[model samples]
Target: MTVLVPGIEGRSACTEERLLIVGLGLIGGSLAAALRSSGFNGQIVACDPNADEVALGKEMGLIDSGGTELAELLENVSMAVLAVPVLAMESVMKTLAGSLSAAAPNVVITDVGSTKATVRECAEAVFGCVPSNMVLGHPIAGSEKSGVSAANPSLYLNHKVILTPEPDVLLDALVRVKTLWQACGAEVLQMSVERHDQVLARTSHLPHLLAFSLVDTLARQDERLDIFRYAAGGFRDFTRIAGSDPVMWRDIFIANRDAVLSSLDDFEAGLARLRQAIECGDSDALIATFDRASHARHYFDTLLNKTSYQAEYHMQPHGKVTYRVRPGGQAQGRLRVPGDKSMSHRSIMLGALAEGVTEVKGFLEGEDSLATLQAFREMGVAIEGPHQGRVTIHGVGMHGLKPPAGPLYVGNSGTAMRLFAGLLAGQAFDSELTGDESLTKRPMGRVADPLRLMGVAIDTAEGGRPPLKIHGGAALKGIDYDMPMASAQVKSCLLLAGMYAEGETRVREPAPTRDHTERMLNGFGYPVSREGDTCWLQGGGKLTAGTIDVPSDISSATFFLVAAAITPGADITLEHVGINPTRIGVINILTLMGADLTLENEREVGGEPVADIRIRYAPLNGIDIPVEQVPLAIDEFPALFIAAANARGTTRLRGAEELRVKESDRIQAMADGLATLGVEHTVVEDGIDIIGNGNDQVPSYGGGRIDSLGDHRIAMAFAIAALRAGDDIIIEDCANVATSFPDFVALVQRIGMSINVGGDNV
Candidate 1:
């Protein structure tokens, strides 16, 4: 018994194949509209019990032909999309099985059901087993309006569509389903049926259930009209989903009963804990809960923005990003860079180990600092905020850290990996530290060897590289160690481990390095003393909670500082900048070169000094960078090279073999980039000599493409190099700029720089 309603008498065939969409509601009609908008080279048709809906589909051009019977729509259908309600899937599949027996044996079948396990069960029941041609998917997007009249072609744009294809499903069927979503401009993903259900129950279903319950409860009250009238925007926004179709939601809830109940149970338990805290006036406990949630949201937002891939699920990879810059733009403005990266890292690490809640302001929300924050959260510390550079950490106290679920992955941060080694070695549970590709190749022997001397059983990759596995439960006794090299990271690692060791731990450096760790330790009520060439701390002292105001990172400020220093008539002031004595080598080097640099409003905050740095264009003569200043300005050397390139004479740098071990071989990386720009430079194993042409009226160098090899500093260094270039400069692999300065492009643009950033990530 078949009936066909033909209305395609005047239509031109799009292709030999056809697509049939069953159930012409919002989901079905939207799919048809999206396909038609994409100019799909195939016929589209639909089926619905309502004849009016079928008429509407034809008039709207969503479908060329339609019928009221499922049996009539099986004519040459290459693919069938069943967009039925969750509870109605069973009856529709039975009809499909009875009708599609021999009509289209090779036709691909898919469903847009909100609940997968139930729809999958229906398919299995009707076909005696789940069909290999069937794919189940759910779109995580929609509008408040429903029906064919409200079909939106852009509903799936910039949203996610998750497909749950069984392992034994046909490859061709899955491909067709994937293609359909991709054509609609969706970011498609795949996962198991059980996982999809579990995630949706907590994230989507539970929230909707709460909204419905809350709305119903308020509506039944005696003062319902007043309550509704006085409700704020937050309440209305949260409860908006309660207006969805009641019958459909009821069926979805029934189908997903187990997961929904489990999620509700967890939510209720948390609510009970909050209730208890309120009744008992436990301000600390309440702050701990609220702060953790607020900061975690901010942290995840950062992850999503830096993403060019599956960032919503926290699975973004460090892929290729490039920056293109045009020659010559004025660097004139008052800018405040991101917080000091070194202090930002220490804030999270020390905050987690302190005794009480720690309040932090001006935390850097960059990739490196975020990696450090995530590491502490993994160890079970409750941290909150970073909403506008403010964070609250609920410290777990000394000797209170739990074991992390897996290896700590510190992306593109050698400082994080090396410092984590010492901090983790003191834990009661064993731990392993790991990092991205760039960090895996850097030397870790300096920190590992020194930590081992204090009775830490450490295992490392060949020649002392990560992944470093530090064995815990060892009897750690402090020792006086003399370091062969002066590295702030190495120094910080040993100092952090000293807190867990027995007796006094003394570290003597051959030269001075940034002492933020010692200074921060003292600020936290743990005593650390420094002599002329040595610093020592007594082991086994506890850290107390304290407030920290992180100043602007001088490393990031150096780019703009150099920009103003080299360009004629350019004046810029950087606000609230960190002027740590040990870390001002860049300023010292620039001052020595006679750049017009000024430090204004000098003061101290927390344990660090802050100032407003003003720098203007001045004639410069290059001098041999002092060997003693090598350790002080190690990171700033890359940008200083650009300053060297514009100076009046040759600028020489030596005794900086440490540059070879940075994010890249910064020494050779800078040399290569300089060579690409036609700037004269001589490279050696340790350092380089660059000849500067100090004629402000003409270009110092000609620009060409330079590969940064994913080093943030190197990429940023050459970006400012365009200010003095004769042509456009295209710097490749600049994505790591987010690791340090997330707003480098926008901030530079705001201050009148001709830079364009392009990358292949979300």
Candidate 2:
């Protein structure tokens, strides 16, 4: 097996083999460090434009001879690996070609670039003759941070390295390159450069571009300063990508313009159709759309969990597991969902308040969901679940929730704490809300003030934090309140309380947030009306409980959506997705960007829409996203950011500043990840701005380490980012991703995105 030889005088055997890596960024630096930690005894020569990085590489013992000059570094190296930004790849490759010509030791040359076609073309054009020993490599790994200081030796272990070679390229050289990566603790795959570009455009480039553009657009909006103040979890999640590096992302967009632009077109079309559906109030059409999308989501979820449950469990006899039924003995088909904390809270709270017996199938059984269920139960609502994934909620009528016995413990769900505050405010109940340390630290005053205005009494810790003592049982009077900022949770809470108010409770916002509450309330026969930025929920309205079937969460579907879009020959079906218009911004945006997305099997589950989504590899293009769409797609920003990075042209996003106050500062996390991958981006107060030209621009994941900041969205978003990076991207504190999508990594890998665990190499 051929091994990379660094700082060796002449062609040597295995004992003297070494590899020289230039630029001690996330990618180059990570390779050097990983090689040593993996017990590669051969010498490692490292070079970087930054003297500090060179010195640090030496100090970290990642290389034997570290310097700033390529000529000096290449003199004794057998193979040279360029792990730099996409814009810098050509220059580095040219330098390597010159060095190879001088030494002429049959040395192999390779580069780590996110996009391959352009880089390969540039290499061939610049060198005049492509070397048979040359290969293009991309390792899908990284965190949301950059620089040599963050480098770890184990970064590349058990990660995927994609190698794209020309038709005439020597098989031996390909095997050699593969062997070298394997030695550094990586799993290798092969693909064509064109295929890589197209797939990445949808999965990585387009998402990043949209995120950067979204932040830029929001930051420039007149009402941004005010809107950001009121931003909450959903908004923060939608705009988190606004914090990425400007220059690097700009380069990526321009480099892969064709594919990105195409994706943008498709995404825009989906958004337009959704907007029209909402404007027309075509419930049937809207429900149909949502149904198809929702079913698709379920299919995706099943695919994601295929490895978890043994075949026997799925193929069990019908009577093997005891089934719970109501008094009538009418058994509904068993539908089980993984512990989706967000959907669980929504399902329990909404189901309890509906008019009739609302049977919930596949309710999440995590601590967070139990907290919500327990709280509802204390308020005279019977919740039978945490068994067989079926939750039976005895409807309490719109205004029938009785006063609870004691304070409600919300556990660790910020969602439960905030949403319950609103639900209780509308009822004649005296309730106190409490939670864990992390949840308590989050702000609650936003919901408290709105509820108070609607005639509810609430006392909380300073700054409107949790541990709230609520004095209810007061007659709520409807009041028109303009939301100070954009927040779906706060808006939803007020809307819920407004359902029992004396008159029409009106809520106006400078910017729109998710409207699931409004949509679901309407579905339950509540007369909720919307005009422009205002939503009116008529009080004293009775909610009729119909069979309400929840679709698979779109947020959960994002991992597979991107995986199918990015990994070639990967066409997976995501079934039973919730296609609620307010939650489909990612689908809308990606479709507008020209992704080859299709919806099928559209139908209604209960009152919600469900559908199957089929997304294939397609070209993507960049677009200027409107600020209004931000609130609609807030939960999907992480996946959207990956799409933007692969898009073409300058994709601008605006009116999003809520990214700062999430479980962690998502903006900062995204920025840190992009920088590690050598992608240039601009961080702004409200959002990020990305410039793209669709040329040769891929970033190396070398120099730095990234921190997830304890945010699940951030962790998953960065994991997707790693799929297209050249160097191993190490994500620290990634356990938090389980909070949302528990099996994100496994799901993506099953669809063919290269990923691994407990290792540094991609």
TM-score: which candidate is best?
1
Name the lDDT of candidate 1: 0.86
Q: Report the alpha-carbon TM-score of model 1 versus the true structure.
A: 0.82
TM-score to true structure, per model? 0.82, 0.52
lDDT of 2 by residue, 7-118 (tens): 2221223224558787788778888777676667788888888898888888888777778888767665666787777887778877776666665466777888787876
Off by over 4 Å in 2: 1-343, 365-367, 387-389, 398-406, 691-704, 753-762
Instruction: Please report the candidate that would top lDDT against the real structure.
Output: 1
Question: Candidate 1's residue-wise lDDT over 453-525, tens digit each?
Answer: 9999999999888899989888888889899998989889998999899998899998899999999999888
RMSD of each: 6.1, 27.4
* Residue 575 miss distance in model 1 (angstroms): 6.7
**Candidate 1 lDDT for residue 58:** 96
